[model samples]
Target: MASNRPAPEAPYVPNDPDFGGYDEQTWEEWNPTEESVRPVRGRHRVHKKGGGGLARSSTVLGVGVIAAVGAGGIATAQDGKPPVSISLPDLGAVADSLPEAKSLPGVGALISDDSAGSPADAVTAAAPLTAAGVSSADAEQGTTDAGEALRARIMRQAENQQHQADDAVRTAAEEAAVKKAAEEATAQQKAAEQKAEAKAAAKKKKEEEARKAKAEAERLAKLAKSFAIPTSSYTLTSHFGDAGSMWSSGHHTGLDFAAPTGTPLKAVHTGTVKEAGWAGAYGYRTVLELEDGTEIWYCHQSSMNVSAGQKVSTGDVIGRVGATGNVTGPHLHMEVHTSGGANIDPLAWLQGKGLNP
Candidate 1:
């Protein structure tokens, strides 16, 4: 049989007579735990606000154990046998040792358990942490801190990569610019050289053309000095061939000019007087030869002024005209011959320059 008497109620307040004066400020200021107190092993003093006899009783209650002057201290009225030593487990130590909670994507739960595969189990079970183990606020704060740190790291890495890319682009642009400048400079140098060469060639060509023109002028002047005319004023008396009995020879071999005796005979061009004297049947004759082997003979001259081998110029008075050759009136005779002694017409040759005898 069980007794049916009701259990007695425990005392709701401390029974120590001296504990009545303890206040909330004293309790709040008291550091009871080893982690909170500065010296783990030492005598600590507690001050009393009033000098009542209860202060002496308080000192007796604090003997043989660590004590503090606060509402939660071990002080009681029942012979001050230190109030039943309550072994309250340390909540702060449990909190400090607890594993950090992880946040799972798409799963709204805090992973607090250190058991292997706990996150996966939590996801499948859809169970959250025990109500007292981890508060929702603490889990959220941890997740926010971790996420902010990760975002900061990612941003830093992205900025570094961007800087590297920009540096590479800048270097490549500089190199390209340098290469282009070099090529342009080389091209300019080559063009300058080519222009110089072209100028030099043009200058040389101009000099050669000038030299050729000078030589041609000198050649013409030399040609003009190699022949002489028979008389300055004359009329054609008997041509090289005329059907008449005017000469001893079968046919006339030279052109005859009818002019007054003592008419001034001029040299037609510049040459050495090869012969200048009287000749058989052709009195007072003068002969001149050009450098190119062409010969001129002036017959029927009244007198001679140039000697053989004497140099004479064009328009020089070389002789006087007269009909001294084979029984003709006062006239002059002229003949032109090649180096092989072939005779040619002199009237046509002289008339080529608009000169009429």
Candidate 2:
């Protein structure tokens, strides 16, 4: 090899140091000329798919599932259904096709979110639609019809209550007035009865007093008539019995009343005249008989004024005094006798009536 070998130009060194005896060296150990260090182009190797791709796919799938569940929850709250994928372009069409929710009475204040579950809830909640300020005209008209009807019902209820209250007040007032009137009437009646009773009692008392006064007057008049004096002015001259030489019956049998020759002789009691004539030794005499059968005789009278059978009352002058019959002077003789002809003393009878004889 040495005789024919030409000079060794370079050694065959492999890129893999372990495959050949070439020493492993850096670029500085294998320094070459600029033309030899030129970069060479070749087919590039593609990288193998790694676990990161799988992890990224899993993350996207998880996010999608979470989004689906969240949509389903909202759908369930609104329409009681699972969520469905919907394109944005289809939303407007579906919303427009949905029917309007029916309104309820006394439910105007209920908000859309307050519903338990309904398809309209989703649409209503999005805008938070409420019945406030919204005209209930359509709903109310469908149910009750006119506005006047509702107003009339409310007014009628109020009027009925007011009428009841007024009736109660009127009844109470009437009862009170009736009670007051009854009480007043009862009081007036009682007062009138008392007044009538008092008047009756006074009338009876006055009648009794008048009766007693009349009886007393009559009694006094009868007493005066029984024992009246025979003359207003006279003097006692001769005793009832005198024993003297000038005597007719040996003793005076009657009392003597002396006065002027023409003194009046009055009746002693109410009587009728029995005699008014002259008699022997008893000139100008008058006799009177009372209702009790007693007799009064006036003797020795100057004159007689009463005739026979004439009615005379007490104090009637029946004769005049004179010196006649057996009298010694101008005097009148007066005698009283019982029905049996028994003579009684006139002076003693007059003294019994509290009168001077």
Candidate 3:
């Protein structure tokens, strides 16, 4: 693993050619004894609180034993040889055999002056380690021995970032769902409003049409009260504008009402008699002129009841139906003329006064 540690300083060298200037106070001389270096059943040692009084020399001997065991195990594995017994070499006599602290392969940082201390000193420290490499943000959570604390901080940071990402995704999804719901609600409201408007419009049109129909019915009722059909119990034989070779004119110019010879012909409306006796093919005819100067002519009559200069009211008998001059059967030939003397269909004129036939 990569570690945040500086290089070590040179090991102490003595002025004497064979041995260094070892001070009794600065450096403690440690020797490996058989009892101190005895192997436990397991790889670990569990010390009791007070009576476990292992000496510092014993701790050093344990480290040396571990190193020797590791080296021996490797050599045995490589040579396909049987496992060899681990034995502590004499450090005082074979001191030159030790590798330089700076040149030690992987443990160079452990013995460095800038590091915490030697392995034994570090393990024996009283206080828990501080969060050295951890940031203040992570350290605020808690502290432990160096490696564990750093590992915990890294795990917490990753979890926190993951939580933040999950929160962002959830927030975006919620916002989108809300927006979609609002849009759908708005569209529904618009559709409902349009439906209401269309319904109102259709209702208004229906009401207007009903009102116009009622007014027209009232007008027709009033016309019916003031006018009358010229004759009753008659079948309509022919309409005006019928084309044939039956008369002087190429087209018939009168509305023919076929009835019995003595069917009474009434005045169509309140009018003055303009001409009563016809001299030609109109036979016994009577002409009535309304106050508006529109003329109504009743021809092909058996006899006339009203004379010239006489006033007549609606439904008054004016003549009798007959088969007279130029007539094939007993009928009343009725003609209408506008105030401007333009000939018009009598049936249409009757309809204008609210008559159906």
Candidate 4:
């Protein structure tokens, strides 16, 4: 029957070298069947039970004995100490009273399910007994090892990710450099092409200008053949810009062609006679306007051959040379004006038109 009374405590003895040695006389030499042996009264004895509640207690107690023996054996070997006998708990009465294994995050996860008997369960076994005996330090070291392994794995993963990121960045930079180089090369090539084109264009234009000048010289040479000098066999008395008081502007303004009276004067170029009469110091004068609006003045003329508005070709007789316009001697005073009425050196002008005079 079940009873509220507590189970009797089992007796255990510890081996001590300081004490008297074990009693070998009380061992197999003691004959319990002899009269000399007697049972002690009121002493509780442990009996093996094959059935009922006592059987459950005996099985639990057996497991506790096996655990203690295994642990003690290991502890005794490492410490070189004598064996220690331990009393087992009353599992039948307080089986649930024992504490449960901890369930902390990593710690709980490491606890292998012994019922499964898997290969991984082997790793969850207890640590070897130390001379100091089994302690929480060994378990903590196991936990720390597990944590360190996890930490190492995470660090490696992070490092790999960093390497991948670095590689990607490097790749991007290289690609950008290649692209920039390609663009720069393209720009340089385009600039070179443009420069070459400009150089070729400038060269072509210069050559064309030279060819036109040559062609113009050829045409002007043929035209010069049709031209003639005004009043040939005349003496060159004075040139344009001779510094003398004989002129009004402190310089001679026209060329003086000294000749006999009534010398036939001719037009220098093909033009229309714009003026057949003139006044003042010039006795008789004529003004011829060329097609390009340049004016040629025939001054100090004794007589005029062409009237106003008369068309005349080069070398056509238009007037006569005479000493008429405040002249020191008989001569024709000829002058030239540009289209804008600017008087330039007539010798240079005639040379430009393919004439020697």
Candidate 5:
């Protein structure tokens, strides 16, 4: 009975004879055909539906997930929050077929196989940094930038304060100027008022004086009508109160009118002749008394025309001029006496009667 299968070569062993280690056997050579053999379990290669493409895609996806987790850890650490717990589904079978993490392109620097390696360090190494070791975005907002902003704010505030102070100063100056102007205006007004008042008072005083002068002139004009001159063609020689050795008195108490002898003497005003003759040094004198008791004495007369107790009118011939008693030349000595027997200047009395002798 011959079987159509090839015999396997036996291995030589140094053992006892029951295991047939010393037997000499013959092997037959045979080649197997497809029809003669059946497929054995796990002996031949079997092709899957898609190939290794799905596995490669899944590996790339896993790498991207690891990178995303690392980025999240860095962000969390920078934010100063607690570390987040991350759970991943087991992909043991896929991990076993994948290459080592360090051997992968662009991913080798991020993930580490060393147990002591820090995830933070690995993430920091992958991120781009500035000269100060911080990220570019973080460096842009660093302490220097903050300080510059603060300084700018302070400058703005100071400028505003200065402007406010200037405005206040200007306002105060304007107010003071306005007050000064008002005071000056008030002073000017008061001065003008005082000047006007003084002018009015002066004008009133002048007007009152002029009125009084007009009244006095009118009174004198009226009185001139009632008075008359005593004699005409006479020259005034001695006035009242003349000092001489020619009379009994040391001073002459009468006004002397020099004229030729026999020059007629007229009554100065309307009066009654009280006496027509003199007995002593006043030779050929005549005395006339008025209604007001004023007396007129005509002395050194050459002759008398009016008798005693005769009423005589103004301009009536009462006597004639002469040098009869104590006379150096022909002249009339006229004396006036008030009601109280006081002698007065005859010239002044004539002027009071509105007559200039």
Candidate 6:
């Protein structure tokens, strides 16, 4: 069975002490580091002012030693016994070992728990550091630097665009030049081809002319071999169309070749003798008819070698020169008549037969 009883009285502890462990000056001079930890709530609440905690860090460390060593014991007014020997570190030596914490003009360093991720995060979770003054010059400098960067970027872009435009123009010019050169080359090729064609035509025309001339020369040479003159050793006495009363028709109608009697008179061209007997005004005359139906007469002939209906070649003796009837002197009188009975100049007519009179 349990009896209802009041709990025994515990020992007493002074929550607030009269010792001014630290002031605001100590907080200003206190150096913090990455390893620094905020004061815990057990013994560091003695110098707290209002809602803010830990006015001085020295008050925290000073009472924290008592709380730690005397955790198992408590003080009472009725007992006086030697306390447990617990050693505390020297405050002056600990303070001297810390580095000086330099801060901005009106901003102070903040104490934070070690579990905080960063100072900024800790500041957000705790108190923010305040700066005395921010400068307008600094803000303006930031704006100027941004503007300068943007300007440099824009300038680079513009230069790149300009270079691209220049490259395009250069490429266009080169293409045009190439096209023009190609055109010129094509025109030159056509001109060369035309020139060659013209030269070939001229060469062909010359060859044609030369061949015709050679053929004509050969034909003339062959024809000259078969032709002959009427008589040799004869003096020209009369020409055709010479006005004289000695001729029967008032004008001489034949070419006269005077020679000694019995001089041979040959056939001028291949023909057959048609008349071999004497005639009234022209005695001892012979009429030779050629294959082309032309008639040739030899008058004033003393004798005849080719009779009527006899074939005679060029250069055959057809008659002789003598003083016959109706002759001005002993000579051979030759007359050439066309098939149409027209008489012409014998010298010019002979030249038509390819004979130089």
Candidate 5 per-residue C-alpha lDDT over 1-357 given as tens digits, one digit per residue, 9 for 90 to 100:
212233233345345254455543332222333322222212111111133322223343444355446545444433344554433333344445545544333454754334425765455444432222334444455522444556655787999999999999999999999999999999999999999999999999999999998887778778777677777899999999989887678899999999989999998888999998875888889999998999999999999998999999878999899988787899999999999999999999888777787
Q: State TM-scores per candidate.
A: 0.36, 0.37, 0.56, 0.47, 0.54, 0.44
Per-residue lDDT tens digits for candidate 3, residues 154-216, read 798999999999999999999999999999999999999999999999999999999998888
Pairwise lDDT winner, candidates 4 and 5: 5
lDDT of 1 at 302: 79
Clashing pairs in 3: 14-20
Predicted candidate 6 versus true structure: per-residue lDDT over 1-357, tens digit per residue = 211122223423334242233221111112222233233333222233345333356555644444443432433212453343333333343334444222323222344333436665433333223312223343344422445545655787999999999999999999999999999999999999999999999999999999997887677667766766788898888899999888768999988888899999998889999999798778899999999989988998998887899999988998898887987679988899999999977777665565654
Residue-wise lDDT of candidate 4 within 266-294, one digit each (tens)?
88889899998865787688998999999
Best by TM-score: 3
Name the candidate, 1 or 4, with the larger TM-score value: 4
Full ranking by TM-score: 3, 5, 4, 6, 2, 1
Question: lDDT of each structure?
Answer: 0.60, 0.62, 0.72, 0.65, 0.69, 0.66
Displacement of the residue 129 alpha carbon in candidate 2, Å: 99
Candidate 1 lDDT at 172 equals: 100
Q: Which stretches of candidate 4 lie over 4 Å from their true place?
A: 1-144, 222-226, 231-244, 257-265, 270-295, 300-313, 316-325, 328-331, 337-353
After superposing candidate 2, which stretches have Cα over 4 Å from the reference? Answer: 1-222
Can you give the lDDT of residue 230 in candidate 4? 67
Query: Higher-TM-score candidate among 3 and 5?
Result: 3
- When summed lDDT is taken over every stretch of 10 residues in candidate 4, the lowest stretch is 25-34
Candidate 5 TM-score to native: 0.54
Query: Global CA lDDT of candidate 2, please?
Result: 0.62
Q: What would the per-residue lDDT of candidate 1 be over residues 1-357, giving only the tens digit for each residue?
A: 211122123244454445564322221122233332221111222222233211112232333233333323424333334544322223333323433233323232432333435555555334333322333444454533444545655787999999999999999999999999999999999999999999999999999999997886676455444534556677887787655666666677778888888999887767778888879787778998866676788888878899999988878888887777675588878887877888878776565323446
lDDT of 3 at 329: 91
